[model samples]
Target chain A: MEPKMPRKERQIIATTITLLAVVFIYGYIIYKKYILENPELVYNLEFWGRKFFLMIPIMIGSLIILMIIFAIVNKILTNQDMETMTDEMDKLIELKALKISRWSTNICFLLAIGSQAIGKEPWVMMAVLVISCFAGAIVEAIAKIYYYKKGV
Target chain B: MGNCKIKNNIRTLRFMANEMTQQELAERTGVTRQTIVAIENGKYSPTLELAFRIAHIFNTPLQDVFSVDPDDLVLKKK
Candidate 1:
């Protein structure tokens, strides 16, 4: 038995894995290219601008592909039992996860202020903000999985 | 909620209803079998509407399917 995990829970777990993989892979590449190989790129806003601009498409594309893959497999396995709609427990779990993500974002903002006040470099602050967003996303996904496992 | 223990007789009721499996009951109640498992194991309490739905599925009274035995202080008031 596959344990009959709900489609919603499965989607949450899959999405979380995708986001984290992308973050780590993309983060490493960006760091090696800008911070290690070409240190001067960190000082240049154009480098950050172009890199993130490219990432927007890459991230969106990867997410869409992931969704399609999950849908295909889920439809095959669940057949008529495939449920894509939200239920009360799903909504509650989503809210619980969203609450944690929002709190993390607020903390990120506070840290952003502190970093600025302490005279950190503009690019360093930018990196912190980006990583914080990733952390928020990772936390949200983990919380959803946790609630799914423990019951909501 | 302050020592409020929500309990259900879903397992006993299912057995009486022709040895119904969790999947069968879940399909009838429009919930996942895991949710049925959670409810039976006392890990999660369903909402009032869902509770009523489950009772209806089993063709039993809501009071018969689920209950919350009041604490001593609350029971003393009865």
Candidate 2:
């Protein structure tokens, strides 16, 4: 394909990178708790569990805010492509991307469940779930770009 | 899976239309320039409705825009 690289694809890529950074930072922080100075933080299951519960809203809000910033950047990056509505081909690519992303997330969920069944730590479960969700978003963005450039 | 396909003269049509840019053609056809490029390069085949829309944007008949080989069909022509 000629591959013009649309604004939407750029936005998707920016968002994916941001999500990966966030996920990696979160993972590092969790890892620190387990290995760093007061190892008690890792054993504090209730605290991590509560923090994990609170993370849902925090992550959602952060992603929303980040996306808005990315959108503004995208507007500045492209001229008229953003003004146009998504055509049928674009929609089809989106559908395919979402399917692959969701499929990845579901597989990650199964892994989390299996870990929980094996009596793994709750913090590990939380980390895996949250990390994998972000990973799925990244996967979708990559897949979308691939299909757009290489054909569906 | 590659047994059948549609062919088009989008590049020729664009050339004839005063060297119309892909972006302009995409805007007229309500799709992204990337999609137009893909279609022109035979990397992607658009839906029937999209094909009609593209042909309409070029002010040409569907046959002039796209052609499917009868032999490629499950039911071949005599």
Candidate 3:
């Protein structure tokens, strides 16, 4: 039998997966409907800048909305407020996950720069940077889940 | 470094203390219930400060609540 996980862990896993889907699906739709259609914009710094700028608020809004809905549902089901207090163990686990995310992000930065140095298009570098950030976020979530499940 | 393992008797102590629930122990110790569960299951070891706090809550000596497993203990040669 699978061991039951804490409510907080389950919340993290669900939110991370849902956010990842929102990001990637939104990105793909934009790439297909807008960028692909306007092939010229692929090399346009201004166009990429506008797209990147728009994405930040959209992602942040999605996260805030998702958290609100998740918290409401969680509260109704569990009849407990969200665990907000940070204890020693929670701090340790968070630090470990942050370390993993930082390292992954650094490596991704190196790879993105390397692509640019190798004469890749500006879009390629931007794509690498964006994808690397998403990868780091997902990796941190996975690391937290692993540590929570298997012990720190 | 290879064989450092901590063994705890939190579950037993809680039982002896009038069948204290994990939630009760966690609230008294200022930690989440999942953390208490993890300690009981041997999935995570508490820090020294937390260990002392747990011992204090049980009104027991620190060594009584937590100890190095004898089988995993390593001694250095002088």
Candidate 4:
């Protein structure tokens, strides 16, 4: 309506992008500083398993906190409520965006499995899996923004 | 066809209805204001039920509220 991203959705996307950036930076640091320091950890399934398991809760917690902060700031700045009605169009756009995200993630999953089936290292599969998930999420967010601004 | 678009008279209808606001229309139609804006601007098309609801609100037939582009029909005929 404003020729820009709707306020509530804009904040959600902004928080998502911010959290994604933080995760990427954190992953990069861990890989470069910690994993490289202990090369054996790369081949250790237990280490990867723990990292993946811990990351899920941490990511969720961070996202919830960020969303709350954004909501508070938005209320202070614009005096608009965070909650909004979801209508048919919103549902339609969400389904379309989700379809795009699913396809991208599925393709990456196949690639990851194929790498494992071949002779690629275990770490390669793990990296591909992680990247595929993040890429799918980012793509979904971008698709939502596009559809919201340009119409679905 | 991709070339065919559903044109609507929502803007005219709103204006004729004592300059009804998009927010009011949205509330009457059980949707968001942005959704009403999108429909009026022809950026999005409503579903059959939604079309009926809008027509009901304006006390018009569905055909009066929405129609296909005549040019598209000509292209189809060609």
Candidate 5:
């Protein structure tokens, strides 16, 4: 019988597989850049669309395969232990976090719209998106801290 | 928000039950490992259903698993 790999080893393997996928995608972008630079190459929306469709399947396949491997490895390492369900406490925390994220996102989006209406630069919209993400994370973190401090 | 307080003996019971692992308890209680850790640390409160499940797992009555502390009460007479 083959020796079962430890949880740490399995996690490393899974992470490596994910990283490999990212690397492969980045390499494809470099290749596309090279093609775009070539005078002989004809670039059009249809050509790029075809490339995107091909890439999607490869990405999806890799993700599914990686997930399956991760599940198998996790099961083996944990001795067939089932995944734990989220308890009520976790649900409450998650609900609070989600509320924070939603409020932040909504407020940022509204502010961005207002800025646009007030004749702000087009690039300002990008800043809004970035700030929204940051604000969401901050709000979630603050909510967690507040709830913890309040003993809820 | 309404103040809802619940007290539980999970920490003491876990120690008496041969120092059972939090992960093991979480699995048995159908909750996330982090949730169990949070509950044990008194950082989070569980729902009624989850509380009953936990009580069932320890083979104890619901009152034994959880209680409302009188000290946590804040009275308001209308």
Candidate 6:
């Protein structure tokens, strides 16, 4: 197997995935409300199917652009040495961060379900989702800093 | 609460055994380089199966690879 990717590359990939997921969810909402309102605009199943398939290329292009930016930053920071992986301690800190993020995400999902059961508004649900994503990211960053400080 | 600090000499032994790199040792033991690094740094405690594998890779006893100190925990007599 290939060596583990550098932390910068991993971060770029993670960010790209998160960005694509958020964009796709928001785009789906718009498509359902605006585009689907006119059946004539729907054209055919194949046409909409093609658009769905097109997301792969769009995501790939976004990832490539992200990687290019990451590569440039990595080169500038490391003086062209990109082969170095993150240190062990840094990886542990990332693991802790991911753990916290996972927990936050799960809690947010449960809260969403709970709100839905209580007849919450759609806009409120959307707000909760957006805020939860940001909160999860913040929690992850905090967890990383905390673990680093604790020397774990 | 119990003292969770664990002590091992994997780093010292790795040095003695031709100064093997963490990556090389990790490969020999069929684990990720990060796992080896974590074990050496005491940031993560490996499971019993992994501990045995590490000990086997170093040609050392299992106790040489990992040990829990119970001195900090007060035990009740049965």
Local distance difference test, per candidate? Answer: 0.80, 0.78, 0.86, 0.84, 0.65, 0.67
> Which residue pairs clash in candidate 1?
none
Write down the DockQ of candidate 4: 0.73
Native contacts present in each candidate (fraction): 0.29, 0.71, 0.62, 0.71, 0.86, 0.05
lDDT per residue (tens digit) for residues B30-68 in model 5 = 776666766776767787788888888888888887777
DockQ of each: 0.37, 0.63, 0.73, 0.73, 0.56, 0.14
Query: Which has the better DockQ: candidate 2, or candidate 3?
Result: 3
Query: Scoring model 2 with DockQ, what do you get?
Result: 0.63
- lDDT score at residue A5, model 1, on the 0-100 scale: 67
Q: What interface Cα RMSD is found for model 4?
A: 0.8
Candidate 2 residue B60 C-alpha distance from true site, Å: 1.8
- Residue A150's C-alpha lDDT in candidate 2? 82
TM-score per candidate, chains pooled: 0.81, 0.78, 0.89, 0.86, 0.56, 0.55
DockQ, cand. 3: 0.73
Q: Locate the minimum summed-lDDT window of 10 residues in model 5 chain A.
A: A1-10
Chain A TM-scores of each predicted structure, in the order given, are 0.81, 0.71, 0.89, 0.88, 0.44, 0.52
lDDT of 6 by residue, A1-152 (tens): 23254454355456646565755675686579657786564545454455546655776676677767766766776565444455445566788889889899889878877787899755445546655766787678667655543446
Model 4 chain B: which ten-residue window has the lowest total lDDT? B69-78
TM-score of predicted chain B versus true chain B for each candidate: 0.86, 0.85, 0.86, 0.85, 0.81, 0.81
For candidate 6, the C-alpha RMSD (Å) to the true structure equals: 7.6
| TM-score of model number 2 | 0.78
lDDT for model 5 comes to: 0.65
DockQ of 6: 0.14
Selected candidate, larger lDDT, 1 vs 4: 4
lDDT of 3 by residue, B1-78 (tens): 554778899999999999999989999999998899888888888988889999999999999998886756766555
The residue ranges of model 6 lying beyond 4 angstroms of the native Cα positions read A1-99, A106-121, A137-152, B73-78
> Interface RMSD computed for candidate 5 is what?
5.1
Q: Which residue pairs does candidate 6 place in steric collision?
A: none
Give the CA lDDT, 0 to 100, for residue B39 in model 3. Answer: 88
| Model 5 lDDT tens row, A21-129 | 5545654684578555763433343544455466557666776777677777667756665343444664576688778778988999888788789997654554575
